[model samples]
Target chain A: MKTLLITLTIALASLSALAQGVKVGDKAPDFNLKNVDGKMVALSDYKDAKGAVVIFTCNHCPYAQAYEQRIIDLHKTYAAKGYPVIAINPNDPAVQPQDSYELMQQRAKDKGYSFAYLFDEGQLVYPKYGATKTPHVYLIQKRGADFMVEYIGTIDDNYKDAAAVKEKYLADAIDALIKGDKPTLVNTKAIGCSIKVKK
Target chain B: MKRFVIYMLLVAAVAASCTRGERPTGELAVPIVDYSGLEPYLNKSNDTTYIVNFWATWCTPCVEELPYLEKLSREYSNGPVKVLLVNLDFPKYYDSRLLPFLKEHDITAQVIMLDDSDTNTWINKISPEWQGSIPATVIYRGTKRQFFERAFTYEELVEIVEEF
Candidate 1:
């Protein structure tokens, strides 16, 4: 009985810790989430690419709105260079109606989004990635058939004005990776709207 | 009687002018500060429990929970609880968005605007557990501090403050 109780306690502790989600150097989880185009997109679909710039964002967040153009610019600049931005909407539509799939399709069409705007139906993908807010970024690199999380955080230092940005953290990390060097900064933080979910 | 009437008129004119002078210009002034300026509020060594909420005008959850914070402030006004709302709205929207929201919501709690662009540094300093999400709160009484990365209801807030 004593041994069983100890095992149960450890298991519960680790389960709670797992709720925090993935970290740097961990193998990134792949999902077949539905895209705005009605096709299912998966990380494995980008097997030929060097890495993927995965960003959790939605339509209603002001912070996400601020970075929308920047995200488009990132895909424009880096997609050809082998890192494509895979945008995901991880909010439950019931919690936030504006982030519903129909609006997501409309927003993508209106904005002319250059990348896949996938919806994490049932809200599964973000919890594995430990995404707490919209505009959270996770840069994953392909390493011997495994996608390893290289960097996790925001797009840059200045979310409000991209022109006035001093530190391009995401760009710098991608640049270092292309040059076959480790990123000096592996993680960062920025204020964003919390990922909406129902109780 | 004529002298008395003249003196009364002069007094009324002076009173009206003073009232006009004291009237607010309709422009709400919220102090803007960097992370350095905000650090002192987070680390006060006093007996009063300070509930510092990091929020913005645009964040939905933050806006949704503002009334609870206001209620908490109102209930604890004469007590040792001090609620400080730290707003993170963009500087460009200060006039266009933030002020209007503040006015519309009738937020009477002490508000301070945080204008720092270096979020990576200050975010960790606020709390390592915070992953840079708004609607996050820090309730502290001197060195005994608790950080919440989620929104709170009035009852939950009251329970926490009571314990503090």
Candidate 2:
């Protein structure tokens, strides 16, 4: 019976590893990544902010490109409100040369991105957040000592058209947290370009 | 003389219809579909092994692997396997972009357009492992099924499908 119990525990542990990344209600992992402006940025840097909008986006993805203006608008709308957008390029530059750090700076400059576009140099942070695709978003609310993952998923209901979007999942989640209430919907999904990783 | 004119008109109509039968270069008839329409194909049980690959034109890696997928589709034509190329391109751009891109690429495999908007609902339902990203694939023969969420080379794709 003891041996059987040990085997079961091992199996469960491996299963959790296979599941990958933090689930709902799990504390968000903190990371220090180089921003486009050549400064290292981390979640803890926004200590006074109510929440953070961490989006795994890249320079090459058309879906990410489509939502670029919307993401910029999100930052312009919410930055002063204390929910700053933190864009990260989680794709491997080896796999996708367009997403290289030098190109990221150029893109940010050309687009006039108000937010800090960070480079996940070794591609470590995204897997911890369970981000499988470019433009995957995670809305985190700062609690006493840890950042609580309030919402995980897409920026809005529509990726094809920003004008026709009825449901703003990311904005709604942030709004709820600012009002000191839990978001009604904590998760959503959209079709996005899978993160390019080297074979 | 009037009867002869009528006969000539009929012949011209028949000739036009025959020439029109030829598609615009490499264009294939790709139907736009929702989950209800696609669910039947995925769940239907049969001896024929169905290799359904979910992809889009904008997805770089997916486009990179297309030639390999097409080659495999051609190779397995004689076997009990059918490659269904399910494109998840945005519905609005079907005519302007997706169809033209299909024609340009000369995609010979049977292509179907997936027009579902609520990806969160269907991605998980397709396979719990899917996090709504492309290009993913589902291969099935009868009740046995396998889901892969990674890119494949020509050799790798053939090996996986052959085992199925």
Compose the digit string of candidate 1's lDDT tens values, residues B1-164: 99999999999999998865342666447777899989998999978999999999878788889999999999898778899999998888776787789899989999999999889989999999899988999999988999999989899999999988
Best by DockQ, which number? 1
Question: What TM value does model 1 have?
Answer: 0.88
Residues A1-199, model 2: lDDT tens digits: 9999999999999898787887669899999999999999988888898888999999999889989999999999988888999999999999899999999999999999999999998889998998999899998888897898989999887787788888988899888888888999898888888988887
Model 2 TM-score relative to the real fold: 0.84
Q: TM-score, chain B only, every model?
A: 0.82, 0.80
Q: Give TM per candidate.
A: 0.88, 0.84
- For model 2, how does the per-residue alpha-carbon lDDT over B1-164 read when each residue is reduced to its tens digit? 99999999999999998865444555448876788778888986878888899998888888988888888889988777788999987776777778778889888999999887667678877888777789999999888989988778999988987877
Which number leads on TM-score?
1
Residue pair clashes in candidate 2? none
Q: Tens digits of per-residue lDDT for model 1 on A55-127?
A: 9999999899999999999999999988999999999999999999999999999999989999999998999
Error of 2 at B123 (Å): 1.9
DockQ metric for all predictions = 0.68, 0.54
